[model samples]
Target: MKYKWKPVLAAMLASFCLFSSPLTALATDNTVSTIEDEMVHNTEGAAEAGSAETQTGESETPVQADEEPGWPSGPSIVAESGIVMEVSTGTILYSKNMHAQYYPASITKIMTALLAMENCELDEQVTVPHEAVYMEDKGSHIALDEGEVLSVEDCLYGMMLASANDAAYALAIHIGGTIEKFAEMMNERARELGCEDSNFVNPHGLPDERHVSSAYDMALITREALKHEIFRTVSKTVYYEIQPTDKQPDLIPMSNHHKMICSGKYHYDGVFAGKTGYTVVAKNTLVTCAARNDMELICVTMKTEGRQVYVDTATLFDFCFDNFKKVDIGSSGTEGEEIEVSVKEGDSPEKTEKIPFRISEDGYVVLPSQAEFSDLKPLLLLNADRGPEVTGAVLEYLLGTRTVGQAVIALPESMIVKPEPETVQNETESEPEQEKEKEGKGFRWWYIPLGILGALAAAGAGFLIVRRQIWKYRWRKNRKRRRSGRH
Candidate 1:
């Protein structure tokens, strides 16, 4: 009877598993939310072509002895176009269709914010115009009204943290008088930053058939943007609030739209700043900046499918950080440590200063972990990258024909013997200011102790005088008692 019942129990157990399996699978899948839950993971474990590829998602490739110079292996990502660039040296750590143009949705605000930061001060007041107030109600905004007054800083927070399209327009109008003029400034600035694959038509990145930018160009723009202290502050902010404007009566609160920064599900360590964007036409685009292992890297991925964009960014960051290291190639700052150069400024025969030509302090090269600092080839040039401060030399560091890094041979700000000030005011006005500074700090090292001793001496003299007076008063009282003869 027991043997006969065993098969029956087994059949029931199998039935239970069959019914519950779908429920279990559904629960596990729900952890991935919103766009990611809808994303088709077709490109998982595959690299979109034309990249020096590695397996996606935390998979690492060891540096090979025979790998090409200055190129490290990067991960397979679903982004249609992407690149990983070291922020300091501007070295291309990873590449995949990097220069290919695509519509760059709201990531366009990076340029808008950059222009605002460069052109305007934080507390500068900006007014909301009619065009900005009347944009499509469907686009992101804080419901600002026409003639609303807010500072440039408030507009920046709204644009960056809330992805507000209206703020971008207002900022555009404030800086360039109109969006059209502002976009021209954007393109001009893009060109100045060496962004060859971009054209800016709008500040808010609303879909226009003519609007387009490339991943490489976006990366370059971001790299330049990060140089400003305020830009860094805006990008990394998780939450912000704007005081009610003239049009709005309530305080407005905002959370960063960049999921990698605010959402714990996709949070990555060392990812300090990022911008996220999407439109039906542009798909998902992302730019993130992270610092780890002494390397600040910018990762730009455009036309990605969904949450995989975040995954792709993290994977690339890990790959670069795990495989490469920054090798310092700066001047040792010691005698015989630098080559001597003759610098004759202004055709003045007064002095042809023999400046010790040393590599700039900012000179550092990113190389594969297997490579050594000794492997870099140094070449010296007479060109002054910085026109005025450069004592007339630029040291170019190369790794097998690739220009890995360049350093300006600069005159130190505190040259034990500095060159004369360039301007007449600087030469004349600086002397008195310097003298005043010297006078302010003049050998007052003894003043503190001397004042303390004087205070103590005064207190001691006061104490002795008081004691003498008290003793005299007591003797007088005793003498008066003796004269009375009351005892």
Candidate 2:
């Protein structure tokens, strides 16, 4: 009977556990998930509130294992030296032997144009120097006669549009006083622009052993040049007409050698402009641009084995647009539930303002869904003032992550921010006065008490010392007297 009852009791307890266990598990799971979501929300709040802009790569998630590379043609274009970079962010999307040194050939003109545009005034008159009219017997030439006068602007069009060595030489002399000096300036500018493995023997990229540049360095130069509006307008010119001069009266008809400039085969629309170059040694160097769906890509290929430079550039552009996209990092266009940050204001008595950030509008380079923001850091560009009508504050922002391209954070325009009534504002006009009053009261009350206590302690210590001395003196006198009596 006892064994049978034991079995019955065990069975009853098992049935009870089975009935209650599911409910208990469901509640625990829900609570854990809520806590997790709350944590994620708080962290993301820092990110959305623009405070996270101060944070760096540590807070970002790891990229997926099977994530797609940024460029669509990343795997397709195989050249001795190549790179595909985002136009706005200057982020490298794809690369191969990019840092390897190779003759830049005419692409050296890109830097030449950059220097010339800033230094030589467009309206300044230039006379062809004898030294520029004649260079080492090799390389392309526009054959300018010595002492011929032309506007500095015409010479620029000639150097860039015709890829003429003579124009490049003339421009260098006009700006630097000599070709050798100009070359020094070019090398100096290269160092300033962070081109570590570059040297310029001449202003125009003729195949001098000293006139060599790495694909990476050329890309860096081009990236900087693209910042100038003149370069974009000049490099992409389909036809340029140099004014007729006394020496050569025929209006020089200049055409861009970049095949994409005229060829309808490649779909390059935003290719506002780019330079082309080639030499037997350099082997078909090409740089070009294109836009698709509002994203512009700059492709650079140097030292290729064939003359298919335009085709390769097009392929690279297509690969990037087809594969990658720009993602806004902050509150600009984030998907799912909206993330917002609440700021307490002081000067302006306005209440809390909700700022939402999204992904698309923030200008971040995003790969396919497989890719995640890896090693991301937020850059906050903020402005503040100590006076009313605060000078136009710019909340400029920037974000960088490994897998995603760098994102530009657009700042809010200058506007007054006010504090919510419920929230405490640290900007109390009476703060100093209140602190002074408290300090004065503390001195009158607790400080007086402490001072009295300290004085008593000192007096007590002095009394103990005096009592010990008196007892010692009395004991000595008594001993002396006793010794005297004994004697």
Alpha-carbon error at 132 in model 1, in Å? 1.0
Clashes per model (N, Cα, C within 3 A):
0, 16
Q: Which candidate is the best by TM-score?
A: 1
Candidate 1 lDDT, tens digit per residue, 409-483? 555443333334566667898899999998998777889999999999999999999999999999999999998
What TM value does model 1 have? 0.66
Q: Please, what is the whole-model Cα lDDT of each candidate in the order they appear?
A: 0.76, 0.65
What's model 2's overall lDDT?
0.65
Q: Show model 1 residue runs off by greater than 4 Å.
A: 1-70, 331-357, 384-390, 410-487
lDDT of 2 by residue, 92-122 (tens): 6777777778888888888888898878788
What is the alpha-carbon lDDT for the whole of candidate 1? 0.76
Error of 1 at 462 (Å): 99
